[model samples]
Target: MAHTINDLVGTDIEQYLDQHEHKSMLRFITCGSVDDGKSTLIGRLLYDSKLVFSDHLSALEQDSKTVGTQGGALDFALLVDGLAAEREQGITIDVAYRFFSTERRKFIVADTPGHEQYTRNMVTGASTADAAVILIDARKGVLTQTRRHSYLVSLLGIRNIVVAVNKLDLVDYSPEVFDTIERDYREFAAGIGIEDFTCIPMSALRGDNITESSPSTPWYTGPSLIEHLETIEIADELSGRPFRLPVQWVNRPNLDFRGFAGQIAGGSVRPGDRIRILPSGLESTVDRIVTADGDLAEAVAGQSVTISLTDEVDVSRGDVLAAADEPPGSADQFECHLIWMSDQPMLAGRPYLIKLGTRTATATAATPKYKINVNTLEHTATRTLALNEIGVCNLNLDRQIPFDPYTASRDMGGFILIDRFTNATVAAGMLHFALRRADNVHWQAVEVNKRARARTKAQHPAVLWFTGLSGAGKSTIANLVEKRLHEQGFHTYLLDGDNVRHGLNKDLGFTDSDRVENIRRIAEVTRLMADAGLIVLASFISPFRAERQLARELLDDGEFIEIHVDAPLSVAESRDPKGLYAKARRGDLVHFTGIDSPYEPPESPELRLDTGGAESAATLADRVVEHLRTLGLLTPPPAG
Candidate 1:
């Protein structure tokens, strides 16, 4: 009997109830570059599973009436194309989630966007994925995007991979075509350290070799896509893994029940199991596991449940609960492989919002060790990263964070960076190793007293961060300020844009990641000077607000003063200090802030100086000196 909309809804509701009764489920993601047929493959998988209802079918049929390539035939891509823009673009822009069930297993599939620009979205979807399905368009074979997607999947440590080779019809279902692509990808996969790989061929549009056997490909012998998905053993892979559950919410209802609720990110948990809360490293035994349905004897990975611990220890959201036997290490510095996603480029020394598990922190890139050339898979000894570029970097967080190597565990290894002001996700990182372990072995402690050093040097160290448009008089005012401080018998160091480039930052270019590293190196140098009690005046077009804030955090609360050197675009262009504004106007620079890229001004600057309309460099310097006097850092010298 054909199931109607009403019957499907009733079955879904009953199944929802039944799911609460079960103790486990699996979550995975489908990822590839655009034109990989990810959406069509997912839609076909759901349709063949009989998970679609009459209403969904009718709606899709109705939606197809006004949309897509043809009339009458159902556009399966419409199933996952929930957004209007996605439909218009005919591409998956955001993460689309779908749920379905087979007789053997229940599954949640996150269909992630494939465009290189939306790599951050891919990270969000894959963050929770235990397995990943990477699609390859057989016609195009292994392209640059293919290698990039494979690198990211392996970097994120997705242990299981189903390499779905779509559009076999385009290649005449030639087994040789399939074998060549497979062998090429297999070699690429092995180089990146991915061991588990299953290659399958199918035409998502025609439904050939999707659910049932295809007689057209009698020469090819492999399980159908649906059959492989249904029978593949995932339980053993999860069972032996270490337990890690990041508490999302503390569910305390009416003062009667108090429990920590979160989805099990990895491993399993049972009643009376001993678990440790990370960052705190406090231990407790699980008292009971409760869901909305009832109590449970055990809860495994991917199950969302609330747990009560016997010893009421201090645990909250952002706290990770793990097996006491194998707790994640708390470290302040770690090495990572990052895919730069933002056009703004990652700034060195700039602070970014780091989200690991449920915890949020401020972190800075220590330095970029090297960038990998995607086409050749070779490490290019570069100092910075750009959009869609992959690099190995070291990060220094404000405090110690509990983390595991991505090779050891995906859940503990992956993290994302959010721009502080725009809140845009700028980068996705995979853990490689913690540098802190080696640091502790060869650690050195300086014996100089900071306060005494300031007194002896006759200056309080500071990082004067100047941000403005490209032609803004940031460098000009910074030079004058340094001159004034030098004459005032104060120990001062000036780090100007062009001067630093000629020396300390000579290797860096104007790309986003280069800018980030440029600011980072300058900030680190400023930090050292400040420790030695020298005022560090830094002048750069530090456009991003997040990067400025990161530089500020490296100093004392009042030590880092943001001086906004304000000037209208027209006025700055008239000055044309470096003739950069002309180049940016000429379309030579792709992401020049205030022209093509956005320059986020400081919302709450310590000082604002308009370098336009009769404001001289000396006057600006005097204004800065007055502000410093207000902070009790400087005074007039002997009333001369």
Candidate 2:
């Protein structure tokens, strides 16, 4: 019987597998601006290395003949660009991951998108990569996307870099051109804090200096691209750091083996070592270590293992187990390098979910302290982060979690921001440092309590919260309510949004982050006024439910009354008094609630009033006052 291809492959496969099982893998990414031949370079590497089989190569040749953009030449890019859109547009729209192996090492290659708008895709690819090959077109050297990609790889902490000065054949393989581009890139990279990189001259399409040193560039002496990669030693930098494992699952399947299972995020662990559960600050001794391949004596960073503690501690998923003496610090507030990913610009004060390791927390990103100009490497002060923008910002987590600086340990330090509503990944971040005040500051005990201050003024203090769409009569009703309170001779203060923004929050704008801060300041002032035994009336759109809930948190039970002044979108738009809704309709306003942005109404407000009807503002005020009196929170004026 004639041997089939599968039968021949089974017999011949082992010949290619000799010594391959022992080789450690290297994960690297190729990135550049659109049409820099990143996918082609990867394809050329696979071909030159003899990793592509005869049948696959034949199919690739046929694919190259069909949709290939290069005239009558095999489009090596076809190997990596699997999507039809990528081939049709001749541009990578998504990250295309591929795999191949060599005699010395196995490899995982990430072909990242290069467009400025797809910068977030580049970030996602580079996040796990150990090294980066940033390509520059010899015809057009050191463009903005080149600089942008260089900055991102640096930010992601990729130490190993190879600057492939590609398409040398197009520039007639000019040595001077390669040198100038290399020198310029070195200078730019230095400003971005990338201290070291190796530059090589190559034409990924023509296969110069890809696997073998190019004959075209006699002046260049650097090793070939594949030679550098094969010999490059990826340092196991985390081995020296403190051991940390974020418990992903509590394996109490049988109750007999209560092992905490997770991948070792940093350093090493073994039996008999003492470990602490973070945030809780509890300690226990390691009793046993288990793995699918039987019991393990020790496990290093990157290994997944199940560990049993001597004591039955209150360990749970999302908890970090760390070396007792060298555990990471915990803080509710963190300074992070944020890479915004969503079309909706990052709203600093609005609630987002940050999933770090196995732990997830409600977090608010402060308006970016500064935005990074990828082209210029300048730190520009900015209020919000749009899609693909990188910025430095402060993140306030709902609770403290174990963390190390992203520089020291990526596994323990990196996190992803998830949109609370859509559950889509909205951003990626790296923890830089914990805010010092979060750990160092202590609350001073006040001598006077709320009840004592209230008694002194002989009145009850409260915050009257009026929330609704803009032009929904929120401010009108709040003003009327405050007038009634003032008439009763009860000490009172009114905080109107426009009035407050002109002074206290003058630096803020209409961005979501700014709105959150605006409401936050108002809530704080309302609490302070109530503390002084004055009833406070606060009126704002307070569009987000999270921000409204945050205001309620600032007040004592029953002291905060959320009044949802309800009105339909049509009613509010029709009654646009300040012409703000008109501006929003004209597309002058972005993130305008009920228009472009979302408005989450209070699920169950303390008071719900329909203001779209002919109901008078005075009628609404009387209803509120009556409710306050019923709650024993109102006092009548003495006879004047």
Candidate 3:
């Protein structure tokens, strides 16, 4: 199947370089069910195209002989399945990327895994792909994974698709088999909004219908895989969209020059074009489009350049510089399609960090509108999304962000949800549109703000958060601390978990979702009390670190003090002050912390009081008061 490249052997090497450099690039992925020959097809494509170097070929041959599953025949799959575990298991586990070039086009093929558990890996590979080569094992026909991947490809906005019916040689190169598979895939594809796709018959191992037409099937007359890929029109429409350049860096070399640098995400820009700094609504004109090769008269999408503003406006990283008249929408809340990628199931009202383009903001996802059933393409009602699940959700961010609909521009519309505590990317999302309420809601200014309230009370307002397992003396110590502060003329209030549940949180239950909401409400209320210039003491068995962190972020730095009321499970259970542990042990109470649910102890707290030790609650409360005095929380009003 190996073919020679004329450019490699030609005397005009410089001419070849220029031709190769000018070729259009295509990014595509190989996907479908397991054992569909995705890796082998890409490897064989690389080999037949003469893109593999001789030294790499030698190592491939040696590796094939030692550990290949091809019975000593040239194992092409070995070329792309580079992971040790993947080779041992004879299955792809990660997304493997390979680059090759024909004379007409340069190609990047991502060999994504077919396992359901690794669906996130496939999404990562497909996120940037211009096309997709959905392979199917001829013997297996269409499968769940095949349908799932097809749905994902359409969801990701990849319109260019090729259904390569692989391993035809195993099925005796039957035309009937290819036709049936194509019919089934097409029927399924149409259900998921895929109106058009190309179908091909081939044996990736035998290299039939890959680089050239195979004699094994005279019934097949379509262009070869290489022929179609080389000529397929993956449209370049980004240049016609409204211009967007997310400022990645503020290039300030000296006092005289200040420029914003980033790759243009859409449309085109020139030196004299007007631009707007987004979320700020500040206008400026492009002064110079500077590049490494000096200044450019014009710059288009995908080109990285530094743009100086004619006006001295405050532009910074995470800000978008867009076409002035057609600036993108800015909103603090949006309706989005989300794909949960983490092993931990998504819980509503839990805070997460969302990163869109260069901007980052704290966000919380509401309960899903609905999750998609990949098999039937049906929508199912769900409270939370498990790994590999897709749902439509409303995300509320702390600040407004500039964005476009994902259909218009992927760079500005696509974002990832990151767990704030672990910093792991938990989900990928596509913004559909901003919520109408985001536009209507505005903060009204007040003459007596938080600072004024604090000044009137003669104290720096603060939230003393106490967290631990149930029956861990958090409320006991917090009450004592508040009493001691009140005696010294300091304004104070205590928000106890049980008392709040009796009234404010009466509707909330003990489910994980309810627990998150419970803490979220308490946090907002604590913020209000602190803003009123009161030293608010909140005592609760707030289990999750994420919710605790959320409460902390609501206040200014040093205004939120975390105090851990420490106690071993044995000690807390033995005390059984509320007899809650007994009910949990009897299986009467579900989702109880230290029984069914988990309690994430604070890794670092401002103060730790070991209730399991010999220290009395009053003594621990005294220690808390002393720590507060050191932080100046209990200091008297300063002299005028």
How many clashing pairs per prediction, in order? 6, 0, 0
Candidate 3 residue lDDT tens string, 376-395? 98999998999999999999
Question: Quick one: ranking by TM-score, best first?
Answer: 3, 2, 1
Model 2 bad stretches (over 4 Å): 1-18, 53-55, 444-464, 476-513, 525-537, 552-563, 569-608, 614-640
Off by over 4 Å in 3: 1-3, 7-9, 635-640
Whole-model Cα lDDT of every candidate shown, in order: 0.81, 0.86, 0.93
Per-prediction CA RMSD (Å): 5.6, 5.5, 1.8
TM-score top scorer:
3
lDDT of 3 at 126: 98
Error of 1 at 578 (Å): 8.9
Give the Å shift of residue 551 in candidate 1.
3.0
Per residue, candidate 2 scores C-alpha lDDT tens digits across 223-283 of: 9887788887988887778999999999998957798999998899989999999989999
Top lDDT hit? 3
Q: lDDT tens digits, residues 47-76, model 1?
A: 877878899999988887777644658878
Model 1 worst lDDT run, 10 consecutive residues:
1-10
TM-score of each: 0.78, 0.84, 0.97
Native RMSD of candidate 3 (Å): 1.8
